[model samples]
Target: MNEVRHFWLGISCLIFKVSKTFRYVDTDNELEKQVGGYEHIVVRCPIKIVDENIVETVQKLPRGTIPGDFLDAIVVGMDMLIKKFGSSNKGKTHLCLITDAQYPIKEPYEGTKEDQVDIISQQMKAHGMKLDCIITIGKLSKAINQKILAENDHLLSQFSRKGVAKMRHVGTPTSLLGALRTRTISSVAIFKDEKVVQGSSEERLL
Candidate 1:
């Protein structure tokens, strides 16, 4: 788990360096305590990728807190984007999820896991919010429940079919870095005619 957390921080920083903008929300369920209490999901206001302070915050984020319900987190993140940008943002909005595919939806959600996944998929398509996921596999990968990981992959497949998501499974930190860089560049290139460029000139939450 420590290795996964370290690699996650590394990917976050790499994304920040290779993308025009970046924002992050840790999916640890402990965040609910700071938010008053759980309301199906708990998320902080998206941290704007403005300076080194954001990197520091990512590095300092606590690890091994109860993992938030994966599907609920997606729903809440989409809601946050809608509240901030409304329906007009279209393809400009993106939500990137990085996980080890080991956690399950431990908390109660509104519907069955299958139902929640379907709804989330439909919502992302309707709102034009691109969803990308980085599924990390490492020394601890064998401990992950195949059932849970399959469900997560199914959700990603739905988004992929809609042409709004990409999923990458990587085993090492170096490979994860390369995947993040490539995905960031490809995503940015969709909007710009020229070659992909990197700098914090726009706003994006991942």
Candidate 2:
């Protein structure tokens, strides 16, 4: 059924802020209640899925690890989710990526982060997946935050500038409630197979 959905939610937390991320999600609130339908991947550089149980997964994340890059974690975790769950039929396979948009100072990944973003955006468009980021900004001014968000929107939209990618600002737990409430899964893109359509007669295959 179109109403039924599966979510691949990822948590990208910094070393010091890891507990806060868990606490926010672990709260007896709508977030926890709604997350039962999702298979969560916890990424703090090294990633693990607590499988179907969201609360237990949050509790089990190791503490005291060195701070790692959230961007790298998001890309890697998303890749895993897409490979494992992507499908051609929009009704059967609907993918949504939810993350807290907290970027670390230094990127731990070997390849260029831009390349990863570009590839991820392209794959998302091809597979018709939706991505939403609840941004948690610290110390940055309002002007800077807006600049970053706009840049991210452009980057994630690829060339099409479609509404498949979304971002929201959430500084505190209270703000996070609003962020969680705004995320609706009904807006997922419906995919069409281009390979089924042949080229025009004028086009020659050399």
Candidate 3:
């Protein structure tokens, strides 16, 4: 009876129950910026479930109305999450956009997908969480610059530790059934591929 539908690719899906007990230390302050530090953070991930066959309800709307409505729903979700979480640190936000990969975004100009990715990557760089990297992990691949992946690799290195993860590994889903089953709760893995681990924040530094 799970309602969630994961993506079609190999992506898994789960959510973390972020807490202050397991929160990273913040060396960065308004007066000084720390090179390596962790603190309370924020994220704004966009998601779209997989589906084929246009709906009759969608057909009733104007050409642009369908997408516009879905987008509004995303914003509403953001507002709700913000209220649940504490305040956002300045405007630094962690953004993850889960899309159908094949779905094309109509950019204002003729710039390629690579161009858009680069722009967002740079913006994420300024934010420093490296959470802005777009995870196009499913069948819906973006026609983007491979160089963007390299950039993401390097940026992610900043978050590396010598050993295991301090938090859980909640992945994006690959199918509708998997999505519904995946918990909107905390999960974890010691080594990235050793075993698909799951647990709570109390099992810290697993």
Q: Could you give the candidate ranking by lDDT, starting with the highest? A: 1, 2, 3
Where is model 1 more than 4 Å wrong at Cα?
A: 1-57, 106-111, 182-206
How accurate locally, in lDDT, is each candidate? 0.47, 0.34, 0.24
TM-score list, all predictions: 0.63, 0.44, 0.27
Which residue pairs of candidate 1 clash?
A: none
Error of 2 at 11 (Å): 9.1
8-52: candidate 2 lDDT, tens digit per residue: 234211101122232334222122244432112233322221122
Q: Indicate the worst ten consecutive residues by lDDT in candidate 2.
A: 189-198
Model 2 scores a TM of: 0.44
Residue range with the least summed lDDT across 10 consecutive positions in model 1: 187-196
Which lDDT tens digits does candidate 3 get at residues 18-135? 1112224311111113322222211111122212211221222122111111111122223333333334322322222222222222342457544544544453344332221123
lDDT of 2 at 172: 53
Query: What is the number of backbone collisions in each predicted candidate, taken in the order shown?
Result: 0, 0, 9
Worst 10 residues of 3 by lDDT: 188-197
